[model samples]
Target: MKQGIHPEYHPVVFMDSQTGYKFLSGSTKTSQETVEWEDGNTYPLIRVEITSDSHPFYTGRQKFTQADGRIDRFNKKYGIKDENAAE
Candidate 1:
């Protein structure tokens, strides 16, 4: 609760370049680019590469490479069987 020393906290739109998702939120971020919103009014739009809409984690596209089952392949290729393996 100060005077004019505080920065401007305004509504800004975040546009996801990957999924074309638009989100409205308050930000101190500045942008020289502007775009017309659904209200027929223009607002500052921030273009980002990825967002939750297209993120791999959110979309469940995360992949964990096992290197073609290296452990199993190695055991099979070398005839090295572990006693812990169940039949």
Candidate 2:
């Protein structure tokens, strides 16, 4: 709580580059670019590649790999045969 020891916290706009989605939040980061928000006020613009708006997990477009067990995967990779597997 020391004075003049903390960075300035101000409202900033984070934009998802891929989806063109914008959201306003507070951040200590600064940028040379600016954007006018819905409230008709300009805020510093920060561009990011991925955000919850366009991420595969958030959008439910994520792909899952095969559900192979550890032993099965190891056997397949190096062609190892399990004696118990034959029984």
Candidate 3:
């Protein structure tokens, strides 16, 4: 490893804006904003739009489009039928 050539890695606080969730981790990224964590230590604050707390996939709020509905609509318009349905 080389000395004095790498960005300084230090503790950083990532805050999820929507859920107000804060976590501490180490990173080379620096921010002008700082926050006092639960441990009473000040760390650089980084605000993010989406995190596991508010993400649809993580929260199981995912909505899937109805593929069968689209197929039925197309078949109704074009007068098409599956072989199983025709039989």
Candidate 4:
């Protein structure tokens, strides 16, 4: 509730450089670039390296890796033999 002490919060456009996806939102971040939005008005353009649009997790391209020799060790320790596993 203070005057002249808060950063300017206004409509800004976040652009994903990788996928060329743009979304409009309110932010206090300042940018040297500007883009004309759908309303034919210019707003601050912030170029981001990765957004949810292009991220692996959001795009379902995420990879999960199991530690080398860990699964075998666990199976041996717990005596959990795979039914189809070879001796």
Candidate 5:
């Protein structure tokens, strides 16, 4: 490890705009804003669109694969399936 050549990795808060979720973690990134954390110590504040709280994958809100509706629509337009399916 070299000295004076490493970025300062400190605790910072990532704010989610849509859900108003806040995540405090350590990073080497820099920010112009700052906010006080639960430790009562102020750190940099970085606004992010997607985080563990708001991201679809982490929150289990991921989009499901569609396999029924589109197939039906295509069958109706091209007249490939039975007539009862059109109804």
Candidate 6:
């Protein structure tokens, strides 16, 4: 609750670079770039590489890696045999 100590918060447009998706939200960050929003207002434009719109997890395009354990992976890589397999 101090005065003259907080950064200015205002509407800013975050744009997903890959998909060209734009959304307006309040932020303390500022930029020299500006963009016209859908609400007929101009706000600071911030370019980001990834957002929910283009992220693999949100878009359901994520690739699942192998579930092999560390020991199993190391043995396979160095062609080592598992002694426990003979028991």
Which structure among the candidates has the greatest TM-score?
6
Query: Worst lDDT window (10 residues) for model 1?
Result: 62-71
lDDT of 1 by residue, 1-87 (tens): 889998989878999998899988789888999988888878899898999998988999987777658788999899998899789
Q: What TM-scores do the predictions have? A: 0.64, 0.77, 0.67, 0.68, 0.63, 0.81
Measured by TM-score, how close is model 3 to the native structure?
Answer: 0.67
Task: Name the TM-score of candidate 4.
Answer: 0.68
Residues 1-87, candidate 4, lDDT per residue (tens digit)?
989999988999999999999999999998999999999999999999999999998999987785548888888889988889777
Candidate 4 ranges with C-alpha deviation above 4 Å? 64-87
Model 1 regions more than 4 Å off: 1-5, 66-87
Q: What CA RMSD would candidate 3 show?
A: 3.6
Q: Residue 64's C-alpha lDDT in candidate 4?
A: 71
Model 3: CA > 4 A from native: 65-87
Q: Is candidate 3 or candidate 5 better by lDDT?
A: 3
Query: Distance from true position, residue 11, model 1, in Å?
Result: 1.1
Q: On TM-score, who's better, 3 or 5?
A: 3
Candidate 6 local lDDT, residue 42: 91
Q: Model 5: which residue pairs collide?
A: none
Cα TM-score of candidate 6: 0.81
lDDT for model 4, please. 0.93
Q: Kindly report the root-mean-square deviation of model 2 from the true structure over all alpha carbons.
A: 2.4
Using TM-score as the yardstick, the better of models 4 and 5 is 4
Model 1 pairs in collision:
none
Task: Estimate the lDDT of model 3.
Answer: 0.90
Q: Residues 8-59, candidate 6, lDDT per residue (tens digit)?
A: 8999999999999999999998999999998899999999999999999899
The lDDT per prediction is 0.88, 0.95, 0.90, 0.93, 0.85, 0.94
Which 10-residue window in model 2 sums to the lowest lDDT?
78-87
